[model samples]
Target: MIRDIFENAYAAGAYSLAGVVLMAISFLVLDLLTPGKLRQHLWADRNRNAGILVASNLAGIAIIVTAAIVASDGRLVEGLTYTAVYTIIGIAVMAVTFALIDVATPGRLGELMLHPEPHPAVWVQSVAHVGVSLIVAAAIL
Candidate 1:
């Protein structure tokens, strides 16, 4: 039974990780396209926003874990439903994270993260998110 639970969690985690990757790519592309003022307003202080992003990613992982626990029986329909729900939740979390960064920062989010400025902290947070997502995915699969 424990093994079954772990397996379900792993599967859920995999789907959640995939969703996170897609969202990250979309965010990076959007940031690249946005102009200066807007960028500054959205994501100026990488330091301040990095933590929030990490927190959001953690929240997403937690949701996946919960779903996995709930669907440990390996019911195909339930698993699919959980995946869809978790993906939607992840997207919502990403949106909220973006909004929070936009509200807290100065100019535009895209411009700020793209200004050739080196923000190791931001990168670290992003990497952490990716790692967590991957772990979750592995648990699910």
Candidate 2:
């Protein structure tokens, strides 16, 4: 039915917009936690460390989006609500995980993430970020 298709399209669009907005919010939160300007480091300097961290942040968001889609079970209202709720949770967990990792390591993760030096430790942290996201997504499902 055309109406069904339209509704599905609208739901998808809404979720997509929500995902993007959540990503921005996550970015701002992460930036605030760190020392340097994330935008400047990521854009002007093209710092790979920052880039890696940002990528990890995106992976966290992706996990929530996937979980949200599954939890929604093809319902528009459920999809929107689940995605929104899970996104916030996912971001929060990710920040906590990173902070914990920083505490365990030699230096602060927020500062380490912005460091221009490319190190295996950051890669490990990035993977951990994704790992935490998986756990959060699994809990949501």
**Whole-model alpha-carbon lDDT for candidate 1:** 0.52
Candidate 1 TM-score, true structure as reference: 0.43
Instruction: State each model's CA lDDT, in order.
Output: 0.52, 0.83
Candidate 1 local lDDT, 1-141, one digit each (tens)? 999898768876765675466445445543444444333534564434434444545555555645554554656556656665554544454445555665676766544544455544355445445454555555565
Superposition error at 53 for model 1 (Å): 9.0
> Any runs in candidate 1 off by more than 4 Å, and if so which?
1-72, 120-141
Cα displacement (angstroms), candidate 1, residue 67, comes to: 5.3
**Candidate 2 collision pairs:** none
Collision count of model 1:
26
Task: Give lDDT tens digits, candidate 2, residues 1-141.
Answer: 999999888988888898899889888988887787989999999999888888898878888888888888888788778888878888887788777888889876677777788877779878987888898788878
Candidate 1 local Cα displacement, residue 58, angstroms: 12
Q: How far out, in Å, is residue 18 in model 1? A: 8.0
